[model samples]
Target chain A: MYPNDGFRELDRQECLRLLAKVPVGRIVHTRQALPAVLPVNFSLEEDGAVVLRTAAASELVRAVDGVVVAFEADEVDAATRSGWSVVVTGPAGVVTDPGEHERLVRTGPRSWVPWPQEVFVRIEPELVTGRALVGGRSLYGVRPPKWIPARR
Target chain B: MYPNDGFRELDRQECLRLLAKVPVGRIVHTRQALPAVLPVNFSLEEDGAVVLRTAAASELVRAVDGVVVAFEADEVDAATRSGWSVVVTGPAGVVTDPGEHERLVRTGPRSWVPWPQEVFVRIEPELVTGRALVGGRSLYGVRPPKWIPARR
Candidate 1:
């Protein structure tokens, strides 16, 4: 059972762990009527961000880039009474630059099995929040990235 | 490993089974520059349709009713080397009648965690497609509803 209190913030490590376990996630964006949510196969980048592929003409490709989008992944283990969810809200951009595209392509095997028309889009997270359900207790929290001082 | 030829078409029973196993699904719609997909917790109605709940102010609420929306749910079992997916494309509408709403609320417990602001939306499926990966083979196909004779 979740606590009656408000959702708690999650740490960076906890968020990353939750994101890694879920293979499919929901990408939320504003559409014509209300916000729309779609599921897609996703992978974690070296920097703990989310990456997914679609078609060049895919609606996903068009709405995500240069827009603020929310990506979420989660897993639930009923028998063990545990589950975790991680959400990344950030501005998304297309990776047209050869170097960045190559990096994403090589990070992992292509997981999406979409129709012939699909392209890839990646989300660079700005805010991350996660929650873990353990023994019927929910632990939730938000974590911001750490910043280091710039060297002169 | 799925067959080189791709996934196989699944039957109605298979589609329902696959749908029950997955917790998250994507609802795709066009509003922004491209199509938008969002993650949602859904329930299968008694009449063999999908049901979703959202707030009255939700953009989805405005766009879904009497609109063609695409709903997809899938599950992948890596260790077993098997997976299945089901896609429903059809017209959606709000269930405003009191009797229908009560029946849904009384149906088996809602799998989704409760949200304070919830409005129910129902999808009247027009076309259904499903695919399954089994024994290194991928099967795919579509199922349209049967036509009934008119009554005197």
Candidate 2:
């Protein structure tokens, strides 16, 4: 609802597009009753679910599974100070079905660590929100300067 | 404690240094009992508390005040797949003292939007943690390739 704030809200479609363009995002969850953030490279499933891998026994796995988490990804240009950011909030669940696990092994993001037997965690895109900040223009639409002709 | 994961844990000093190097980061908090993340341009105070400007009437101000929040910043090189990330978890508060507000207005980050009378929110750096992912080396200490001579 905010207008003329140098930022525009991105629709769900646009949010997903921006999210898919970036391989890394920060995950926000609770740790020890306090908020914690971790960066991970993630890949999106066909339905826009986020999938990432971590050690099967890692604390992150234990802390995030079946809990609500927020994931954010953004791309900004330092020179222009323009970019878009997307945040997805939803329940996080560890992939347990053997068939789904097998499919993920072949299609999901590979572990960045050398450790083996990584577990897959999927974050359902229940609440998706995004915003784009441009120095003076809209990310999806650009208008010519007033002095410039509309045609040509 | 977990080593050899292509990532290295960073100390508090290093985390602060990296955090100071970036102009923008994501702030994580709770909204309606669900996690939410928002990107904001922030400045660091002498004690490393994060100061960011937001609209005085913004929802973020209400949702985060008197609550623990998490802030994250990172620098990653897509080409080499190497980077460092830092997470700061602490209490968030709005600058209330007229003296502090006046001082912040002079030295803190200015509002990016064209809105007047912005508010300054400070997040204390309580539990600062960071990690660096340098493909084959540490961000703090770079080791020579095994084949390279020690003195070369």
Q: Which structure among the candidates has the greatest lDDT?
A: 2
Candidate 1, which CAPRI tier? incorrect
Give the alpha-carbon lDDT of every model: 0.58, 0.74
Tens digits of per-residue lDDT, candidate 2, A48-87, equal 7999877677777877899999988888654466777888
List where candidate 1 sits over 4 angstroms from the true fold. Answer: A1-13, A23-41, A53-70, A78-82, A89-94, A109-120, A127-129, A133-152, B1-5, B9-14, B20-42, B52-71, B79-81, B89-94, B111-120, B134-152
Fnat by candidate, in order: 0.03, 0.25
Model 2, position B47, has a per-residue lDDT of 86
iRMS values in order, in angstroms?
A: 15.2, 11.9
Tens digit of per-residue lDDT, candidate 1, span B3-99: 1224466777777777777655666665444444544567876555788765545566665677878777766554444666577667778788888
Predictions' DockQ, in order: 0.08, 0.24
In model 1, what lDDT does residue A101 have?
76
